[model samples]
Target: MKFAAFSGVLIDHSIQEALQLTKKLGFDGIEIAAREPHLSAATSAPRVKEIRTVADGLGLDIPVIAGYMGGFSTASDKESEQAFSEFQRMLEMSETLGASMIRVGSGGPNAFLAEDYHYAKAAFWLRKCAAEARKHDKRIVLEIHNVSLVETVESGLRLLDLVGEDNVGLIHDAGNMYITDTDYGRDSVIALGRKMFHVHVKDEKRVAEAGSPGTFVNRTKHGEEKFLQCRLGEGEADHQPLFDALKETGYDGWVTLECHAPFPAYERLEHDFRKVKQMLGLA
Candidate 1:
């Protein structure tokens, strides 16, 4: 698997600076976040091309464009249409930036609760997105995030089956599995199998006490507390098994490091990138 850095960690920095930092840290590629001070749907085509030129000049590949397109699965028809229109714009920008994949969320907890209807809605839009993506030689990937519809292996498989499109796949995030199941192992990887098109690497740790305000934390079904953002190798996520599983499955895709810890951006990037390299036997 090739290593990439998610630019969301450096949200305060410009896209140029983020790409520069990623390359300085020895990352093979970058996953651009569709947010402020970075590329977004509202960004002009010239700006997108400029960002692409800068990355190409630095020899950095932009493999995936990560954005919150989950709102497309909302109950409101008007809201879903607006969200999908924005998704199409992002998809166009991603193609312009030379990215082959775009990361989208599986709606939220409510979508999972209303499984049958939401699943069909998600499939309908995802199929449309996949068809559009194919026209641009790109793909639309659903990330397995907490509170998302496809947070588990079973749920993800169900959604994938519903979509039943070649260009639609899963971003197998072990950290998310840790947040939801506390099990980041080979079994999940084996279950995802060929449907795993991308990967997001992070770590999670359970905090005994309530975490600081604004921190991303969730409670398990049994009422245990877990923090989604933690220092690399300092959490419950065991990445070695994930690496082994990826190797066993011959998975060759972008493995982007997502640094959500409350640390200096460069520090988080350097530490997590090195840790993942070590885990993958590349350090």
Candidate 2:
């Protein structure tokens, strides 16, 4: 598997700068954040080509363009259409960026206990996105994130079945899984099997305090629980087992590092890179 750095960590810098930093930190590729100050649907085609050229020159592969397309499951008919239109633009940008895949999400509002209608809506929109991505010879991967329709391996598999497209896949994010379902190890990875097209490497530990929360804690309206992002070995997310399981599945895809810690971007990147390399026996 190839190691990548998500540009979201370097949101303060331009995409070109993020690429340069990623290469300097010994990453094999970059997962471009499809957001402002980096890349977006509104970015000019010429600029997109320029970024692609820069990445190629630096020997950085643009494996995936990460985007946020939440709320489609709960959106109205008009809203769903608008969301699909926006994602089509994102697929076009992904092509221009020379990315092999685009990251999407299952609809939100934390529909972990919603009815089947909500899931059907999410599946419809995701299948539409997958179709658009397939036309561009790119894959659309849904991240296994919390507060989404698919947070666990079982739910993710169900969504994939619902989408029913060969181009659709999942991104196994251990940190998010750890937050939601703490059993994100070999079993989960094996469950995903070939459906996992990419991986997001992050580590989080739940804070037990009553009032104070750490900088990395992700607090939401659901509760005051804290999932503090920290160094790979320092957190509760045991990624080595997950890596082992992925290896067993022969998943030769991008394993992108997502730094949510409150530290310098370079520091977090370098630290995660070293740790992941060690885990993969490259160190």
Candidate 3:
């Protein structure tokens, strides 16, 4: 599998600078964060063209759009419609960015609806987006976040079934799965083997104290959050078995480096980049 990294981890720099850093760090691809304070997919076509040129110049293939966080659910029609519209906009940006897949979170507030209801609604939306994606020859990839309603493999599979399109796929995050209180990532690998489109490689180090209520207060405009982004191999995440499983399953997609590093952006990304490359034998 090829190596990729999230552009957000290198968010302290310009897109051109990020590309240079990624190339220097030995990543073969990139997952662009098309969100605020970064390159939003809703930007001008000329900007898209410039970014595309820079990516090509740096020899980085953008396999997916990473920060398209649109909340989707069946519990509310208005919310669902808004989500759908956001997705449509993201698809257009995906085309401009030369991204084959657009990644999204699997759960939200209305995620507690009945299984059938959730499945039907998810399927309906995916079908619509999948059609648009196909027009641009792209696919929709869903990242399985532990906090989401579709946290487990079974739920992810059910959602995939609901999506009901071959063009849809999965982006498995090892760190997220580890946090989810499950020992069955391999089981998920087996279940959604072929559907696996990309991988977000991160190792987690839990903060038991961080789980304490009101331990962190929201004083900033961005809201309160306290989880440290430790460098790879410095966390509690066990990626060895996960890597083994992916190898066994013959996964050939991009293994994107996700650095939630405790260090500064440059040092953290550089450190994690080298460490993951060595760990995955890409060195």
Candidate 4:
């Protein structure tokens, strides 16, 4: 498996600076976060060209472009339209950025808020997005997160079935899953099978109180679990099982270390990268 850095961590850094930092850290690739301060659809084609040129010059791959798009399952037509339009622009941007996958979200608690309150509408838009992505040979991967339509692998698979698009898949996020489930382990990958399009790595340990009320705390069969983001190995959540699952599944893709911890960007990059390398025993 190849390791990459998430540009979301380097939002304060310019795109070129981010690419340089990633290269300096010996990362195989950089997952570009397609949002403000880093990139957006408003960014001109020439600027994007410069970014691509710099990354290619550094011999770093752009595996995925993270887009903060949702609202497919909304009650309001305007909201859904805006989301799709943004996604359209992102698709075009992704084409120029040389990324094969676009990270997206399922409509979170807004409910998309349909009267029926089901995910059919979200699936509809995802199908359209999948078709559009296919034109560029890109895949649309939804994050397995809390408060979203796809809070679990079972629901995510159901959404894929509803979308019925072969290119649409799910990102296996162990940190998020650990918060949602007490037994967040190898079973997720085993269940996802080939539909596991990408993997995000971040570590969080169970805490007495996460400070922000109702944020990280969740009720599970094992009672309650509250979490606080921590350095990779220092966190209580074990990444070894997740890594072992990836190895067992023969997943040959970018295992991106998402730097969401409050530490300095460079420290998180080097430390987490080294820790993950040691955990997976990758050279």
Winning model by lDDT: 2
lDDT string, candidate 3, 1-283, tens digits: 8888788887878877888888887778888887655577456778777888898998889888875554555336686667667777777777767788887655542223335655666667767778877888888888876545566566677788878789888778776665564554567688777887878877665554464432222111223334434677887677777777877888888888877655676677678777766666767
Pairs in steric clash, model 3: 204-236, 229-260, 229-261
Model 1 Cα lDDT, one tens digit per residue, 97-214: 8899987765755323655877888777778778878888888889887776787878888888988888899888888887777355899888788888999888877676555732
Clashes counted in candidate 2 amount to: 0
Candidate 2 vs candidate 4: the TM-score winner is 2
Q: Each model's RMSD to truth, in Å?
A: 1.8, 2.1, 4.6, 3.0
Question: What is the lDDT for 93 in model 3?
Answer: 73
What do the candidate models score in CA lDDT, each in turn?
0.81, 0.83, 0.70, 0.81
Q: Tell me the RMSD of model 2 versus the true structure.
A: 2.1
Candidate 4 wrongly placed segments (more than 4 Å): 110-116, 211-226
Better of 1 and 3 by lDDT: 1
lDDT of 4 by residue, 104-149 (tens): 7777542222233558888888888888889888999998876667
lDDT (Cα, 0-100) at 3 in candidate 1: 85
**Runs with alpha carbons beyond 4 Å of true place in candidate 2:** 210-224
Please identify which of the two predictions, 3 or 4, would achieve the higher lDDT against the true structure.
4
